[model samples]
Target: MEPPAPGAGPDRPGPHDGDPGAGRIWLARAALLGGVLVPLVAAGLRGVLWVLLGVAGLALTGAGLWWTLAHTGAVRACGAALAVAAPLTVLGLYATHGMLGPAVASLALVLLAVAAAGRVLSPRSRAGGAAPAPATAPRHPWILMNPHSGGGKVGRFHLVERARAAGARVTVLTGRQDVTALARRAVAEGADLLAVAGGDGTQALVAEVAHENDLPFVVIPAGTRNHFALDLGLDREDPAAALEALTDGVERRVDLGFAGDRVFVNNASFGTYAAVVGNPGYRGAQLRTALHDLPELLTGERTPRLRMRSGHRRAQGLQAVLVSNNPYRYAVGPGRGHRGSLDSGLLGVLCVHVDNTVQAARTAGGRKGGLTRLTGTEVTVDADAATVPVGIDGEHVMLPVPVVCRIVPGALRVRVPRGRGAPRGSRPSADWHRVLHLARRSGPVWHHRPHTTGG
Candidate 1:
């Protein structure tokens, strides 16, 4: 309804203009320091018992995670129970000892700290290689809108009417024909731009076609999760806003990750998530299916395992492997956990392998633990089994073993509106050093301004 502003929403302001947001940066620093001290102060008050209880809970949680990801049957159930009970047990201990206030306060401070970290760490702008201004608008643009994707975001946003109103032809997908074929038909019919108002699965298909035809591809973000759109800094909440790119836009060359020859806008998932998502019930009964399947699939009789080879380094007995188009920075909630650049020109690989609780504990603090992350031009995933279940862009599929993944740098021409907001996860990974330095430079309390989350 309103004018287009990518990544902007009711809570997130649109087009920052000239604001550097210095005041909020200092507040974020204060929150982070307070987040740490509150817990320490609480522990100091509770003394040895508090320290022991926290360690015990973390250990229990670690053990539960180990078993949940690698055990089955009764053992698996107990592991799940331990995992669930660990945090609750700590809370209970706090409540029984009259330390409930401290516990809740510490937790709230920690949550605030994380949110502040996200706000501070997230990049205010794309680092470099800003998209070039487009020379001309498309003479004919065709968008395929999935009527059901993202729980009917296309219809809910009235994307059809909006896109058509923008002078672009719209086709609502009704499972009537192959989506890739339909796009090809549109391109062959002299459509100069290719766009999709659907999920990442559909985005991949249309994106590949656009790449092959040397046409600019626009993502409408009318899909569930829309990881690609989020990583690209598009407006997820307003799918219609992306249509602004059709008229006023810039062209940026972005890379696409490929498993074998299949293209993916996001990452190719294997092991735990892949196995669970491959189940048919995932669509109709997601939570139930995940709860039922995760434990068994993780450590069942014939648990699926993978071996990841990123360049020469190899990690074996991996419970899961995520091969992404580009590396993802520190992620928990908000601001981080997505790729910073689509044109990083490397495959981001994450390998997980924790056989027991000890390994899990070590992993919680040490780098040599079971988890491994690295980037390479090419990475290969192999399993002893002839085939592996893979979740490519969240679309379940069974692929032959030794699924090789690689990044084709700047392989696609992506069009986004010029005045887009900061893409999600663009400034992932907080630098504590930066925070400290910023605090010293922020001047005194008198000079400090009210905190603001700039658009």
Candidate 2:
């Protein structure tokens, strides 16, 4: 069978490309020599050289990790390595010298070097401030901005001027208005592209309308930690550049998650966590409550009795349940916080069996309760009670006890800014660059066209 895309397959060969069998043989031999024979030989020689070697090893590991975030691939590969090596180096030095003086000095120097290099190479902080957004195509695009998104990024970022200047017609929506109605109206009026600037919940609503109308959608990230947009590589700070791509960028058909009658771009969850977020002040007090009242939440009588059945598997009396459309559950590395990829179709189900106080604390990134990973097209969460508070795409929803969710493949079309041109012989990917170029040439929409037909 043909291998999947680079990110699609977990075991695909990456930058460490070589014959796997041969590489393993060499690696095993190297480990044997360095770990067993060399160490034994050095001990027999009764030399003080291990201290210097250990220090050098720690310094090198610290340097690699300190730079990994800048190099995404390296971050994936060696993020855990550096985290482990730094501690081991420190421990070894302490064993030898009984003081962290030399080890601390070396680690600091290496970290400083890494920090300096990061600052020097960071493009976002360059001296020229920020350049004018490059131009794009002349397509007639309509925009819907939520002023409440990401602490009001739309109003703060000058996104409208940039987008209008890049050949898009802009509209801002304030207050509790219906975005779906606005989006559907735009589609009916023959708007070629419709982009929404807001959180994932708002994105899901726009996507539902776009999907129903079979219209192309553009994502202008204006949410706190816009995970989907970031994964798609759209510039969060530059709406003009993203808008230019919509006028001239490449379009990709992405999936959307369907939960009963609702749709979402991310995941959904139930239980105490959902109840917490549904509360008026969940976002502001999540960390605080998670720390203080967790004991009561875990051991209290208020625990909702939930019964979950996904595919053929079943669980009972669950305290908290999280059903994700595309698993964003991932950790930076081993023993790290949970993290996940957004593109994978499988939902990550994390159930917390919080029957006792200790178990509840462990559920909050603690050491007691563990997570479960499953693959299913449809998930059902049922409870004995009548109404249950559901958190869908970071927004609360009031629904009946049982809730069902499934993945809708290729349900939405989104225009994203393509990277630089492809190499010779490779087919062109997203045409973002070309789109931007064309939009720039078309110039801004100086006047609104006269309304005709149904518009």
Candidate 3:
């Protein structure tokens, strides 16, 4: 099969896709080797000892992270202190050794080399890359704009005027109105296309109506954090840019994640986060509210111990969980925290289970660490209580126990302008194994093929 389009596959196009010749691959491998050697040669055995100290500091930081979940305020404060002290302590030790500048510079070089190697050597995903269908202008397009969202992003961007000029009907959600009702009314009034300019939660409500009616849906980044729009590669800074999709657009089918009966365009967060968001002070000040609320939730009389199951795999006593429509692809750099593809037809599950400092230290970089990542068609999360709290795409709600999360493949048809472009590809995690494979292979390999998961 052909490599999937840039935005439709886990391994989207990176810099190497254009020209991945053997010479470049060999150069990348050499750079990675050189990077490792430079640190060893410069730091020497003594430097290695210092680096070990740094790693110990990382372990202390991990201990701090785990302590933040403690019920005692003093313990949480101490944990925060350890997290802050780790790097400062490392810098001080280097300064005392009089090799601070050289060591830091060498570390930076090592990082650059690793990034380059990862970009070139890592394999791209080849699943769910089907070409999006071509689309024409809708006769009656309707928009539901939330004035309060994103600090009045709709009014600030003049979206209503521009959309009206483009011959689309627009309705302003004045206050506490039902978005689902407004979306349905628009469809009943002959809206061939449905769109929303609000948070992901509001978008999900309208999207469900659009999906059921077989209409195209457009998203505007008018939320506090436009997670869905960012993944779609829409210009979050310029909310108006999304309107172009109405008049000049193409169609791409993407899946929606479900927590019980509610649909979410993004991931569903449970346990600690769900409780934090439910606090009355959360919307006013998130960090402060979470700090105030965490002690009780973490040390409550009846802590909510979660049990998660997917297929034959099972995990218990997780503190929190994030379940998404498709697995998110993360890089070591900037501007890429979105999913690799929304049509992967599987639920990406992340279970965080850290009972103590040791587990926290052991589970630092995810998988086998405290944070467990997996993918399956369905996942069930249950607690000791009859009902559980959930944060679905930033909206707080309570779901019945044994809450089932599932992926609805091709459940939403999205429209974007033909001029739409993807965000910069995320750099994959460093893979020494892939680098070695490149060195051993006889011929140049620059194509993508299918793999199950964990790529």
Candidate 4:
């Protein structure tokens, strides 16, 4: 079948798409724009009057301290004292000058501006143009749910009954069963649609079977962080709403990342992150373990020797490597974790090779210090060791040397609810260029004249 045009689909129209809520959305956008610009103008006026000197001093000091901490794995007592003292000194100075309130408000406005910018610039749903699936519900729909996932979401939400009500056979996955085998059996049993309500890892396994058998796949967001579901424009907060897809849904072809035989719905990570997740204690205390291991992973000489080759370029001694199924937008604001388009049929590769804490600090500061980011259809990584630790959609495993990662374009038919609209956090923030253009045109000093061709 031919692919649908971008933003042209049989899916339900969004609130901003000629719906009654379009007016309200426009009003909100206007408010957000005002909120972003008003404060910036006010701050600029203050800066012109030299009233922002104190704020500038405070900001610079904070940035310096943050840079210091990033460069040094361990903070010295003197450095810690300085970090505290610099902020206090700024506060005290502002308080003495009776400018504390204005300074605080300025800072708050800056934050609001950043948030508004994100909301305005975030990309709209690419799924808008996807073709509609069959209006009739699947006759033999099989849903494999993990009861333990998302703290027993299946039981809490009565997903089995809900699935049954939607004409689906529900199977609760326990520790004893294999998800891949279960999916295969469901296919053999003549299941028309394969669905899963679990984490991305489990969902990926079932999705692989569905893709291989040329069956439509439905995703129920019952995971703690349903990155795949979010990308599919499903309601992550409400798993029950996803059941609507089985009956009324749109079929979208999305790209999937593969590392050898294993498939991942989100991303396949290597180097530091993969090693950290491979630790036995990581699942229980993820943050603590990551924090404890990061210094060693970043600083120690015993770091794993990782080398990557994508196309004609090659990189080595990387601290971390993230191979996303689709390219993720990295900007200095919110809405950074989402993909612009999932069917782009390309892998997003980010390799980090920070030699020292200072370089790491600069890299974190967006200086591109020892960081290599590119897009390709395939990537091959070879580690010094015989086996390399890999993190596939948050699940850790040990894979053999020379791990090959590639993007499988349009390999999976993802079904999402017709009324789901755009997924949360998928919308792009306002375009600064457009905003500026409008601003310049609206100015009292600017005017335009119509031109005629020998009329």
Candidate 5:
């Protein structure tokens, strides 16, 4: 076939690449507005108050511009500007007036700028803390919407259209597209905020892309069970709400987990749960089946061999291993024990060692008496098979036995709703839940805590 026509490499498109320069003019204009002019105006005659206000105003304006440019899919220069502006601004202030207060004030202003940028740029906040000024100007927020997430609510909810209308400048990815690749491309193309509309696993995939570049991510819950989203206090039922939050919501920093080289925004589990979830037939199973089958997973008899190491301790034959960046344990009702926070910088490991149904029941009951046990951080797991399928944030991957997992402290920013339980202190929610259940089996409704960390 004539060597498949010269220069026709399968991966390479022949001489007909689409024009990327088409939007350069608009990008240039937007840069002039959001990046330079806004900061200049905001920085007018900087006194302390003016400086602070200018910092905030300029930061917000810059964030808006960054998002706008991102929506239009423009080139990145804003991020570079962000990287330098705060320090330069501080330096200039110090050089102009050498005094402790001025110097400190300048530094604070710089921090404020960083925080603002970080907030807008962060995916989710630990507790909606302000954004940090990026090490570089932030690339725009790249949003990937799953129209099918939340029952095909993408268009019905008017998120993409409204985001575009609201000057968000969105790019909608088709289901057939490689999500991970798309996220990487967006980052390379200058995205600081990588937003996704999907389930927990989808969020994890997008998070993988964001983490690779140290970019912040925004999670829009558009999937069933939305455990991660609900945990983050994102409104999964409404796409419009999520879109608004994506642009206007508060930004905060949270933690993530690193298992091998892969990054996870939530918990990673294996054993019976993994097998169940991995099975294509699992989703079709009835609730009765779930009740009947789930218990058997912890028995170790039904589940295959599993070996694990946690810091100094090593454990084997674990029926299930759940390593959560932030413990997801929560009380079933009010006045219950502490729930884990998303930003606690700790990993929660739950391993099942029970070999019988009675023992499994105690573990499931969250009582300290069962074969189900809880421990903290830095764990490794291995299997007899050279490659054991692993579940990360509910997504499965094949890896050699003895998978190592560790907490990557302060790696993500998550948004969590303020809860009412902790007017006093934060304790592990499982313990508290157990206490509350003992007091009254009926239990109170679980309340959201003010802190970002969960039990």
Candidate 6:
């Protein structure tokens, strides 16, 4: 039997397909209430609950500090302080309270029990299923790898040797040559399958060539933030595992976003992000560059005034605009960071037209007070200047005014190893509705239905 598309599956009923019925909603609410209350009641009964809370808070805070340090790299002073203070504070709390140890011990046991319960009650976890190897897999594949990306991930992971073992000719990109030219040459030399181990910028260049030649493309997520890889359900943490696709992979078609002639696998942005990325210093000091440039871009008298039109809606003097391949659910929690389906033939448009810097900061912080968002098949952006700067998948470029962004549905064919699991922290959570359905002993609350092009 033929395997389904990478993520597509049999059609099934969903909440939006039909009304979930009034009774189901009410029952869901009850279950949600119980889930919350039960935890609180248990904590209240234990006198040492305060100690457990303190430990958990410290651990979470420390984690946040580490993440900030890793991403920004300029927060050494604050990170150092937090690193020293957190442990000492925890130690002081433990010394002052004798019962704290017993409380923590009990909490650990409770957590274990809860985790086990969740594992048993949750729906079965699906394995990464295998896809039939593409015919092109037999040919000697050419892989363009960016060693500098993800802090020299290729060298650190010894990816060249692994690719050679998988019957691939690997090319490590140094500063001397152009990536797109090299990719075109490889295709001309009869490369059947093309792959890249780099960030989205390099991925886009290679993908564009592959798409034009009708070659199956493989993505190895070896970048600081592999947004496209995450959306494709590729394992971002394990770049080596991506090679498994060469032997056992399935082909799936996905949409690609275009800004004029340039293609972007992720999203493109104009305004604040574009201006900031254009700065040469952004690569070394992203936080510092953003802090210094944002004010000038937002408040300066020379700030470019942008006008955008999509369908009947028109926006003017926007401080920033982000157009993604598909709409992202900002209301959802962290788990919703990646797109669930890439075959959606629509562009996700977000326009920021703030009155002042404060409003801009609020909007950047994810508050949607002055934000205008919409989805369309195509969007047009015009600016007062003859040319405009754009950040396409984090790479800055200049384009003539009246930038047209559109979605090319199913334009790129991607291959991934069968049964490859979703990226870490990207799986959707079991919300209240799912709990209600499960309580009623019905079928799977969330079904993996095949995504169609039309809305």
Instruction: Give the number of the best model, judged by lDDT.
Output: 3
lDDT of the candidates, in the order given: 0.75, 0.57, 0.76, 0.70, 0.54, 0.69
lDDT of 5 by residue, 313-342 (tens): 666776667777765554435533222456
Model 2 — which ten-residue stretch has the worst lDDT? 421-430
**What order do candidates take by lDDT, descending?**
3, 1, 4, 6, 2, 5
Candidate 3 residue lDDT tens string, 236-339: 89989899988787788889988888898888999989988988889999988887777667656334888998887888988788898787755555754567
For residue 225, model 6's alpha carbon misses the true position, in angstroms, by: 0.8
User: Number of clashes in every candidate structure?
Assistant: 3, 18, 3, 11, 42, 5
lDDT of 4 by residue, 219-337 (tens): 99998988888877777789999999888887777888899889998899988889888878998898777766665676674447789888777889887789899766553356447
Superposition error at 417 for model 6 (Å): 1.2
Worst 10 residues of 4 by lDDT: 446-455
TM-score of 5: 0.58
> What does candidate 1's lDDT look like per residue over 326-394, in tens digits?
766664446556775677687777788766678886665323477777778888899989989888899
State every prediction's TM-score relative to the real structure. Answer: 0.78, 0.62, 0.86, 0.74, 0.58, 0.68
Evaluated against the true structure, the overall lDDT of model 4 is 0.70
Better candidate by TM-score, 2 or 3: 3
Q: Superpose all Cα atoms of candidate 2 onto the true structure and report the RMSD in Å to 1 decimal.
A: 15.9
Candidate 1 vs candidate 4: the TM-score winner is: 1
Task: Give candidate 6 regions above 4 Å deviation.
Answer: 1-136, 331-336, 357-367, 421-426, 429-455
Instruction: Name the regions of candidate 1 deviating beyond 4 angstroms.
Output: 1-52, 65-77, 95-132, 301-304, 334-336, 357-368, 425-455
Per-residue lDDT, model 4, residue 372, is 76
- Which of 2 and 4 is ahead in TM-score? 4
Alpha-carbon RMSD, each predicted model: 9.1, 15.9, 5.3, 9.0, 25.4, 9.1
